[model samples]
Target: GPRSESGALDAQPWSAAAVAEATSAGRPVLVNLTADWCVTCKINERAALSSPRVAQAVKQANAVYLVGDWTRRDDAITRELQAHGRSGVPLYLVYRPGRAEPDILPQLLTEGVVIDALKP
Candidate 1:
């Protein structure tokens, strides 16, 4: 089971093993790449994170929410962002655990948009 609050999906961290588990279970994963001081990221958290629809989807899917912290400038993550062609925080990716590809979400998030995406 996922150890998180009903609406605190973004507040949690993800391990590679957890992501693998979700994929192995045929579930989707939600990856939120953000720093501590990104305004857009905070808004996304407030808007989408608190939405009941999103919370329900997360609870039901047991989605692996990967939050990569870039506040301190980690070289590994820097390489990842560069590889992805992204140079900023608040990057979101929804991937199927075992799947190599991820359906990436933009930095801006709306409740309806997230809910629609989470529907299976």
Candidate 2:
């Protein structure tokens, strides 16, 4: 289990296989696509994703957290961005159990927003 700089939770590196496995097992997944130079990403990490309430919510939901760092050129991350119709970093997606599509969160986040998204 890997934690982000904000120490929000144990976030594993993003991988399609891992995400698929979690989804197939009826587990919630939170995917964070960010870059080192992205200010908004940093803000979200510190303001919302790192909140203790958010961490508790994630744990209570038994969710899997995955982070995709776009600090460099990564084909997999590029593909994901393209698939999601984006060309930049700071993408937040929450996949719930049995859901085919994930909930795309806003660029600016708050503790309440993250907590609400984690709700069933």
Candidate 3:
């Protein structure tokens, strides 16, 4: 995954094991599953994830930000999408520490919604 120039998130490369490790260590994780050609994904990135409030909320929560790029049909990303019952791009998931499941965000994002999702 490529890092964004915006200072809001330190986007890391996505991997199943990395997610497991972060959650196991009691850290909240935010996974943004997006693609180069996904209009919705681009919209969310600009309208919500890039918002100062939402960015600050994520930073304040000490969340691990991971971005999975499905622009090239990666198998791991495909498996993850299927596991989440999704077959397309622009999926958002928040994995809270000690939680068995992640909170799924809508394809259309808002600062308030993203801030709420990052809440401990």
Candidate 4:
């Protein structure tokens, strides 16, 4: 697992294969699909995802944090967005162990929101 300079969990590049592997192994997974130019994404990152409480919750849950960058054209990311009936960035998804479908989180977030989502 990667750690940010602030010691929070650093998100890895998103990949369908990695997501599948984590889920199959019964690990919790958090996927953040964002773009460099998305203001809302940046806000959410600072307000929630970057919080120490969220980081601790993730670490306690042993969840993998994966980020999909949509600043550039990415066919895989586009397909993933389409799969969830979304056509843009700022998509947040939480995959719990043994779940077939992920829980889609709101575009806006708070530290409590992320911490609650990671709860078993």
Each prediction's TM-score versus the true structure:
0.79, 0.93, 0.93, 0.92
Over the stretch 74-118, how does candidate 2's per-residue lDDT look in tens digits?
889999888889988888889987878889888888988878898
> Over all chains combined, what TM-score does candidate 1 have?
0.79
- Candidate 4 per-residue lDDT, tens place, 24-94, comes to 89889999998879899888887788888888999999999998888995899999999999999889999
lDDT by residue (1-120, candidate 1, tens digit) is: 223422556545655566677788888888777666888877887788667778778777767566667778777667667767898777777877566877777678997777666666
For residues 11-112, could you state the per-residue lDDT of candidate 3 as single tens digits? 887888888999999888888888889998888888888777877888899888888889998999999999999998888999988888999998898988
* Candidate 3 wrongly placed segments (more than 4 Å): 5-7
- Selected candidate, larger lDDT, 1 vs 2: 2
What range of 10 consecutive residues in model 1 has the weakest lDDT sum? Answer: 1-10
Task: Looking at model 4, report the run of 10 residues with the lowest lDDT sum.
Answer: 1-10
Q: Write out the backbone clash pairs for model 1.
A: 23-97
Quote the positional error of residue 76 for candidate 4 in Å: 0.5
Clashing pairs in 2: none
Deviation from native of the Cα of residue 48 in model 2, angstroms: 0.7
